[model samples]
Target: MACSNLGHTGVTYTGKEDLRETLYELCQSPTITSPTGGDNVAGYIDGTEFKFYKSDNLARPAVVNALLGKAKSNYATVYTNRADALWIKHYPKMKVKLMDQLKPTEGDGAVGVTLALQTVKKWPRQIAAIALKAPIPGGGLHAAAAGLSKDLDLPPGSRKKGLARALRYYMLATYSLVDISSAEAYEGLKNYVGALLVSDQGQILAAGINTGSFRHAEVSMLLSYFRNNPTATKVPENSVIFSTLTPCKGCTGFLSVTKSSNCVIYFGQEDTGKDGKVGKKISTQLSEKTKAPVGRSKEKLPGEIVPDDTEDTEGTGVVAMGTASEIHKVQVDKGLTSCMGTGSIATQIGKAKHAKEVLRSGSEALIHKMLRTRATDAESEVKHAVLTHIGQWLGTSRSVE
Candidate 1:
């Protein structure tokens, strides 16, 4: 479904395990001789003279593959086995120069490099600036549209430029599927401050897609945000599986992941205004929209704040434990009638599905096919569709609030 258009470059998954191994070796090497050097240096590694190129040249693709899957081979009918081969081939000439540009900085002049630090300083401020500078809360959609517009460096009069600005605010506001309080307040601040200005006509859809593509560019923008929080590498038993669609610039599809099952930390979006006015509202949007019988029941259980008793075998830990039962409950809550129904149904497309046919016969193919098709729709629809499909699978009616 046009993964590239959706900002899914597919390069992120190209033999990630192998690429990781190579990166590990590079890290151990003496290539990173100086954190603040512009000169090229060479040393022998395993008796071979090795040239130290840029750190990103060696690391960026690996990181990309870790997030996305693998890329398809363009020059050949057969798929490429090595992900690094592409970088080694087309990118070899550019690596040295790109690395030089990304080299460690000596002072405040470091500017574009050290993105993690740059993002830390910039993101919060950006949020505040939007909030404080605008004319109205939710009315300052243009400010959001313009700010993201600048971030993307979108060309003047380009469709993507307008979309970027709108999406920035839209994401913040829509984070709560059921409510728009925080987002509306942030938008309102921008309008109230008279700091926000927009010349572009309504072109948010195009801008959103472009912003989604920037997900790769601004990878470091969210580093601090993600780093501070922990996520489960594997699915958790207490994990509540909720599916939703988030439109980042271009890519929007079903993101079925778990929020903390026990303690749902609903940190409102960061304050972007200059006055430090952060959270203005606490809406139960996520809880209400993704609410299922399972989540409700779990939330009903008393929070584990009681004093610890060593003899209590069925302690809070046990209650919070992620087990098959919990996962099953979540899956059921998603509206799947059976365990297999929870997965995408596209993979099983074009196969026989009738009363006489066994559900498992071509289920995998059918589900994958369905997922491929659904991934291409608008982000909002994709989200709603996933919820609807999940609900249907669980034998729930389509009229869910």
Candidate 2:
């Protein structure tokens, strides 16, 4: 859960409301000369400067303390106050370069530098790439394995690189959990895909099966989680997604919507002879449809997203990356919620029960503790709704189907 934005300097001061006063004086100061090499810079606050310097361990900077509810110490701690929350750590020192420094010229109290900080932690880095070659539509297990092996850029070896590596990485990283889509669940759906959203560290952000024949499992989890969770900030940011079957039109199209830039490993390989990898095909088509002049209006096209109204047939088509004009015909069933709403907990395992207790107690180690425990299975729409509700509460989505 590392944030990709950060090396930015921060503001420091004695207390709350003090930072503002300090900034006001700093801005109005004639000591810091206004920018020159121009004709006429007519304004009380024409330009400003921002400098990044190593922070002191003495006390929490006013800005930092206010943002992060930590002790009044700016010193970096090894742990975090909020569980499942990503925090920032500042770098020691670096050369400070003022890039296009400017300030507002409004009437009263218009001060402070228009600035942003860069991170020393270059995030969004690829940690691992897993390729799953499970049986999928239009391809069998053998076809997928061969295709995946041939398409993979790994050194020549067996077809288990992604799978084995993922498992081993999971074992090595103990702060992990594995969510499983139980075989006993979601019996009504047919020709639907299933996936386990695993991180290298055994954490399972989601275990989901497709809502029905048309909706992809990945799409189901993403939409449900993102829509329900009020703050869509916490998520599996940099981990790769490993799916048993090759991604189809529905699931592949969701990459952009989910903000999913991580490496995606699925079972199907391109025909190689002609069809190309499924990833490549989808990327090409999506690119063609989504291309537009930069800086153009940000208005979304008709089909760019699966409409919020799942009841409307118009929104039930393929949602390509940024483009969504072309409508693919699809069969719709009664909405997912109404279909799978009958489950009740049969026999709750102690550990899973305890995890729920921790959830109730509001422990920060929510997902980590839940992953280690086991739970009994019960199939009903009610059960599914309850699990989905818990997953959202934990900042993710979960469902039997």
- Which candidate ranks first by TM-score, i.e. highest? 2
RMSD of each: 22.2, 20.4
Off by over 4 Å in 1: 1-224, 227-401
- lDDT of candidate 2 at residue 325, scale 0 to 100: 17
Tens digit per residue, CA lDDT, model 2, 5-91: 121235343223333332233333332233332111011211232211111111111122222221122322211111111111221
Give a tens-digit lDDT track for model 1, residues 278-334: 111211112222221222222223223222222322211222222223332432212
TM-score of 2: 0.26
Question: Residue 300 error for model 2, in Å?
Answer: 58
Stretch of 10 with least lDDT, candidate 1: 113-122
